[model samples]
Target: MIGSSHAVGTDAGKSVENTFTLDYQVSGVSQGTITNDSAYTGGAGDPSPVIDPAGPTNFTVDRMIDLAVTADNSGLVVPSNAQDRILQYTITNLGNDHQAYSFSIADVAGDDFDATGLEITYSRAATDLNGDGDTLDACEAEIVDAPLTATVPGTAAGSASYTCDIPADLPFTVELSGDIPDTLADSNIDNLVLVAETRNPNAWAVEAVAPSVGGVTANDADGTNTITGLAENVFADGTGTSEEADKDGRMSAQSSFVVTSPDLVAEKRVWVLRTESDGTACAGEAVPAVEPTTEYPTPGACVLYTIEVTNTAENAGSDAENIDVSDILPENVAFVSATTSGFNIPGTLTFKKADNTTNCDGTAGETCTVALTGAGLAAEVGTTDATAQLYIRAIVR
Candidate 1:
């Protein structure tokens, strides 16, 4: 029965109007989850992006490691006669970075440290990492190879120290070895350096000494002879000092020694004693008298007298002695003997006898025979040339 009530509703339905509203919440939307499925699915999108942990922070080195040597600050001091000396050294690491380092020493290759005269040993602590006193092989290593090695604790480094025995008489050289990663990174580090020092001593020296001579005696007619030892009769001329021998030491003196044997009578025979440093035979001077002393010549007639003279050159170890005789033949008297002693003779005169008949054997006192030749002999005779010397032997009788 849609009768009367329905009639009112039909009219309302015919006049009714309809209205609609739409709203959307996007907050719930997110990048689609990425599932670990073997095959790709069309509905979901790619997963969320990811950021990698920052790469290792730029590598940093707070400070570089350094190596240095410490020993006798200025240098080593050695005694004059010292044969060997000990030298010590401390190696330090001045750096902030932990380092692996090493050290070594060797003669500069072809060069020599003169170990022959030196006694060398390494400190036990320097060689052993555990500090159990032991020699390190690195201590003996040379420049051509690696020397010391150690892994320095982080931010701190250890020391590799050693000692060397050097010769006081000679020179020495030192070198180091090991990896210096920072300074020389690519290949094995080969840095070559040389060190050295010297030692020497003082010296002493001596010089030659001279001697002096005394007067002599003579006989009037027959020949008289006397002998004397050079050492006892002679004295050193200058400072009679002695010294030790050294590098540039020296000594010098005059080798000339003198002798004076005189002529007493006009026909008097005289002979001279002479010897060499080696005690060898020598030549003699001869003279002849114009007037016989028996004639009783006038006072200032330049009385003729015969005299003999002898000279001996000393050997390396010997000295010369001067012998003199006087009283018989006064000054300015003419000498007729084969030799004249105790007087100065000029080179221009014929004083040396042709046969040297007046020459005396140093060992024997002999009479001299003489004959006058050339212009009659002139008196005053002496050696024009004088030689300074040292004598090893002498005879006084």
Candidate 2:
């Protein structure tokens, strides 16, 4: 059977405060009841999840791979007087991400660039390094302005390339070019630097060789003679400096000097002053002779005469006298090479009286004889001349 239960509660109301009371109890044991609380509150707080923007991607450049130059890379051997040469450069991208690079050259010491005629050129190409199916138009090229620019279609990860050409003058500076972009990370993108040397083939040369000097004759008038030659080297080494063309091409320190004795004559002797080079003497093909006139007399004519002989000779003399004639010989004639006509022997001779008489004295009926005889006669005759003339000679041992 079902049983019922009941209970009661009270609520109070007062003058100062009002209150209500009510109570109720379950009539039978039954299932628990469910209640709904609608007016409940909680604390305030931040939201659960948030979204963040992506960061900038950094580009990495591997080595400036497969760098190359199209010029005579073996090295430019230019003449010192030649103009500049043209050079080309090629650089490939061996990096993973797309990258940019720049190029520049150095104006080295003893070199010049940026002249009016100097110039350069550039180009680019993009190709896959591996045999991949990806086709990327990552090739860009431009003239090397102050800021060089080149774009590769695909990322620089595989096969990106660049090329440049440079022309120079005056052996001054070498041209450099490459694909390096101006970016926030790197402001200067110079990829390569090189130098070309110059040479001078004709820098040194011989300018002149002196002409030969003529021979001189020895005479009593002039004592010393001189022979000379002049040579010079006027070429330069393109640098305004003198350089030696050959090791032994210089002029010798000493000049040349010479003296020669003259040829034989009737009562006169001759001497010569020959020219020389490097101490070697040179004789004239023909001996020079003095022309005789009334002023210069012959030997043994009893005429007024003067003798002139070069100082180089010690034994120079002449004889100008008539044998058989009583006339004293001219003073100009000294005993050089002499001979007698009336004497028994032919030799050097002196004039004397037959009987030691002074003033051309001799026997009363003997013609006042004066003649040469004996060894003294031969010695005197060898130095005496019949023609009233002077003789001269020079000897150098």
User: TM-score of model 2 relative to the true fold?
Assistant: 0.18
Candidate no. 1 TM-score: 0.18
- Per-residue CA lDDT of model 1 for 1-397, tens digit only, reads 0111221122111222222222223576644433333233333453442222331122211111122334421123221121223344433322221112222232223321222232223222222222335534342223122223322211111123222211111112222212111111111212122111111101000101221111110111222221211111111112111211111111111110011122111223322222111122112211223323332333222222333332221112112223333322222222333232333332122222224543323323332223222222232223222221111111222
- lDDT (Cα, tens digit) per residue for candidate 2, span 1-397: 0011111111001012122222223575332222121221222542222111222222211111111122333232211111233344333221111123233233223322121133333433322312254424222123223233222211121111222221111011123322211111211111123211111111111112211211110111232222212112111111111211122111101101111221111223333323211111211122235442332223222121123211111123322223222223322332122223322234344444334454232123322223332421111222232222232211121
Error of 2 at 355 (Å): 99
Error of 2 at 266 (Å): 80
Estimate every model's Cα lDDT from 0 to 1: 0.23, 0.23
- RMSD to the true structure for each prediction, in A, is 48.3, 50.9
